[model samples]
Target: MTQAQTLDHTSDQSIEHRIGTAVNQNAAHTREGLLERLFGWFFKGLVYAQIWEDPVADMNALQITEQDDLVCIASGGCNVMSYLMAQPASITAVDLSPAHVALNKLKVAAPRYLDQNAFYDLFGHANKDSNIRALDQHVLPHLDQITRAYWNKATWRGQRKQMFARGLYRHGLLGQFLKFAHALCWAGGVKFDKLLTAQSLDDQNAFFDQEIAPLYDSRFVRFLANRRASLFGLGIPPAQYDKLAADTGGDIIAVLRERTRKLFCDFPIHDNYFAWQAANRGYKSDGTGPVPPYLEAQNFETLRACVDRVEVLNQSVTEMLAAQPEGSKSVYVLLDAQDWMNDDQLNDLWHQITRTARPGARVLFRTGGLTDILPGRVEGAILNHWRYDAEASTRATAEDRSAIYGAVHMYRYEGA
Candidate 1:
């Protein structure tokens, strides 16, 4: 062959090789991005939408006092009981979930009426035998026939009187949702096993960014973007999904990435057990480090002392606020509840907050994104008087992992 022809042939082969490499890289990036999106979609659908209860953050954020009468959205009743540990005068707990109502009732009665040792064994330890014993000995006898029957009816494959028997402590809808997501992670080639074994925050963060972030960038998550019905399991109705998606610009990945990055990065992973629950279905059996406040040894006595102050109600904030006397409550905690409301509901709730405000009443809640709740929803006349400490809210959120709330806000009503 001629020398010029040989040179041209070699150059052509090099160009083809470069083109193939570029094509391969692009394909890998697209494939990875699609899977990450799927993880976000299904994760949001089955987990956050259906059965998440942010008890740890909610209780820890507000310093409840014996003199304080409080109102809260009692999603699962865990936080209400936790707050009662603070010895609040009264906790008017409300929820739209009937299932949640039944669950909360059990919690309220368990601590108030159960023997201290039994209560500790049942909830503090969350042992199956002790849970059943406590239910039979204390809780069952005190609950109304209606609620009692409800608990008696719901049974798992291996358990009877399911609410009374507590083996599946982490097998709620939320737990199952996480389990499913974890399985998906394995299937997607992102190894998350280290999360279970991470000895330090640095290890946890590295595992999350290196292993989990890639999972967020997958195809399965992108597919989830279109399936609203599948998300009902996560307790997100169609309407809320539209709003959440719209608010986050239809990219649930970015929303989750930003919010969860704070949880994984800002605090010591050990200190934030809720984050552990989020990443790993349950906490490590041996208490090598900090546990949830409700599970902490020191706080059990406090929890026992004032368990009766919390009463769970199956109603909306408007209904509960209406039922309470004006100035009856000194504190109001609404955790991401506003995300579920429309404009009218928002206005009505704030009006109740205004009327229910004692001289120095305070209100705390979370928002889906970083915006303050008052600006568009509550009237300026009422909103302007109350103080909005954005910095304090940011600080509180940074410290709390169960706080998926883009904003953890507090408003104090300094009414004359």
Candidate 2:
């Protein structure tokens, strides 16, 4: 069966049905606005190519230990793999999107079965012709029936497995968006490649100031930045757009400029794969530069050994946590998923989180705006069970290499 057919066949399952209901509710909600409905539609079909939030900062916030059991929302599945580097006792990766669930399962399964070079070629190099062969011979045999069916189906570009050959970074919503951005940079006479050659922070800032900063000033670029739809490529829902605009005093252009500056100039390029991917459209080809924690050769064996500890599930975070035994999990990673939710949804989610959290359990998440949404949204009784770590959150937000989010929040459950 084709990709569409597979999706249709699976639409009635609990996870898919729940996600579909949420999408429809968001679209019908009067307060969500037209743009938000559009964003909902876009997100329902979107597959994130890479997770934008910095996992290094996340690790610092969560402070994962061997005794800890983690639950995180799996987006592109990169951070889940990176979290394996922490060697948590286990990780339950929950996502409403089947594509994300499939991707996470693939990541977990690939490292265990494939050899180093083959694994690297499939994900790190991401453009090898042998990737489909590797997937067939090594990866496919190990995937679950659902995940196997998802990847085996034919896509517009050929089989879904062919995405590895074209460069995995060039396939999804974010990937296609970045590709368009590169084309725009070329049209604007900005040499984005110069960023890859910079040896120092000074050189990085200088390059950005000379070649990159000017692109944002163009009328065409500024026009695009002002529109809510233009940001769907970056996984920014309409609610997130509103938060960002409110935070920036409604100057979207200035907000984009500042965020882009931080991405390009605020951090050392050698260690920031986020910057490397932005500039070159993939990771550093030589393998000496920055890559995701899981892709680093030193962590390969560790990830392989620990891969089995992760369980990828297609369900809402609230649903998953409600099904878990109370106090079963020690760490929670909610990656800006709350921005898409309403007050009731937030209350329901936090209720489950608070119930399932062990003593001193830490919940770390990012926000589109700097303001705390839970204070007024969640019930005071449920809210009182958690102590918000403002200082650590501020520090983590400052130290985050991604520089795309407005705030990183850390909450600790007090436990009865």
Worst 10 residues of 2 by lDDT: 20-29
* lDDT agreement of model 2 with the native: 0.85
Local error of candidate 1 at residue 273 (angstroms): 1.6
Q: How many residue pairs clash in each candidate?
A: 19, 0
Q: Report the Cα lDDT for candidate 1.
A: 0.63
Worst 10 residues of 1 by lDDT: 42-51
Q: For each candidate, C-alpha RMSD in Å?
A: 17.7, 2.4
Q: Model 1 Cα displacement at 227 (Å)?
A: 3.4
What is the C-alpha lDDT profile of model 2 across 231-296, one tens digit per residue? 888988766788888877998877788888999998999889999888888898876889889888
Once superposed on the true structure, which residue ranges of model 1 sit more than 4 Å away at CA? 1-61, 112-121, 124-130, 154-160, 163-169, 230-233, 239-248, 287-290
Best by TM-score: 2
Estimate TM-scores for all models.
0.79, 0.94
Q: Model 1, range 117-235, lDDT digits (tens) per residue?
A: 56655644453566776687768888886567656663445433442344334555565656777677778776546766677878878977887777667888757646755444444
